[model samples]
Target: MRVVLDAMGGDNAPQVPVRGAVQAAKELGVEVILTGKRELIEDELSKYSYSGNLIKVVDAPESISMDEQPSKALKKKNSSVHVGMSLIKNKEADAFVSAGNTGAVMAISVFSLGRLKGVERPAISTVLPNLKGHTFLLDVGANVDCKPHHLLQFAVMGEAYAKYVLGDENPRIGLLNIGEEETKGNELTKEAYKLLKKASEKGLNFVGNAEGRDIYSGDFDVIVCDGFVGNVALKLSESLAKILAKILKEEIENHFISRLGAITLKPAIKSFKKRIDYAEWGGAPLLGVKAPVIISHGSSNAKAIKNAIKVACQFAESNLNSYIEKNIEKYG
Candidate 1:
């Protein structure tokens, strides 16, 4: 399978992405097409030794910056984001992975690949490590403002992903709300609750509402919310994980006894760190698009980019969009 990497999109552009692409081609055994200035990409690629045919380069003179407006960025047809997306639109590549501007990637994807037949809006689905393995959350930052039907669509898309990709059977779906009661949230979620409950009859396992504390409890397999709330939750959780790790390290160093204990528990600590590392999952898939588009963090490293490529490959191989389309027909 072929995967396109936006080599110039991330914070450590060209270098990190190029290294990651090479690693993916070597380790994952997939052809990688790096999109960026040909000279820059080739320069970084020369640092690594690999099979000539496994990695290719496409020149995209322009690049969309993280701070650029999505609408304005799209006007640059030669931008890396646009070119990479176009490759997928033309079927030259199976999937596109970018660690660039999230808004630009999403906008370019919708513009180039279009949306699924019945999809009103595309949602970003992220898998977070939870007590029971993991939890799938949707609308992590795609649509800040959504109507009741949009949340229903998010639930349907989230459910399809959890069941097919994550291997969850009858995935428990929940609406992110303040309280567990049916009428707990604002009009959007309250109205969305009724729609989700009704959808439960059509095959969705809508399990009432999910409070903030239940997110990592793993009680629910999938949680749907507006982008505003979901994004805040995602960022806050990430920060908390980092701060907790730092605090633990500081405490361990503060006392000689604690430092000695840390050495004995090093393996466990390492395992815990791995569980919360964002690089493990690499990227989040933008559902509802015609083709598989994986969006990585803007600050992604080589490992993250490589894993993102793996996710794209898996997403494409699963024929996930077809399953989502079928479910949308059933639940919409």
Candidate 2:
């Protein structure tokens, strides 16, 4: 499969992304097209050892920075992120991967690739690691304000990801709300609950409302919420994990006995970090788009970038767009 990557997207820019492209090409056995300032990307790439032909570089002179306005930056046709996305629209690449500005990525993707037929809005579905396995949360930061039907569509898309990508045969769908009752949440969620119930008739495994505490408990495989709530939940979960790790280390250092205990539990701690680390999942997919697009964290490292490409390859291979389009029509 051919994957196009924005070599200038992440915090470390060409360095990390270049290494990732090489890794994906060498280890994943896939063709990688890196779009960015050609000189810079090549300079970073020269430091790595890989097959000369597996990776290709496309020159995109401009780059959109994090602080720039997403809508405005998208106007730069030569920007690396925009160019990377365009590669998919032109059918030159199977998927696009970026660790750039989230807003710009979303905006450029919609403008370039458009939404899947019958999909009103494209939602960002993030894979959150949980005890049983993992949970797929949608609209993480895409549409802050949403209508009732939008949530229903998000549920449908989330369910598809859970089943196809996560390997769940029948994924349970839940609405993120304050209470588990059907009568809970604002007007939007309340109405969405009714729509989801209707969808269950068409084969959706619609579960009841999922409280915030249920997020990591793995009680539900897919959780639907507006971008505002989902973004807050995602950020809070990420911060809490970091803080908890720091607290654990501090507690261990406070006592010699605790330090000795930590040494015995070091293996467990590493496993725990791997479970919650965003790098492990690579990046989140922007569902409901015309083409497969993977968006990684802005602070992604080489491993994260490489894994994001792997995810892009998986997405392209799944033919997820065809299934999503059919599912939307089934319920539309």
Best by TM-score: 2
Residue-level lDDT of model 1, residues 1-332, one tens digit each, is 89999999889898999999999998999999999999999889888887568899999999788889999998999998888888888889999999999998999999999999899999998999898788999999999999998999999888878877778888999999999999799999999999998888877899989999878999999999999999999999999988988998998899999888887897997898788878998889899999889999989999999999998888888867998898788888
Provide backbone clash counts, one per model.
0, 0
Pull out the clashing pairs in model 1: none
Clashes counted in candidate 1 amount to 0
| Ten residues in sequence with the least summed lDDT for candidate 1 | 45-54
- Residue 200 displacement in candidate 2 (angstroms): 0.8
Candidate achieving the largest lDDT: 1
What is the C-alpha local distance difference test score of each model?
A: 0.91, 0.89
Measured over all alpha carbons after superposition, the RMSD of each candidate to the real structure, in angstroms, is 1.3, 1.1
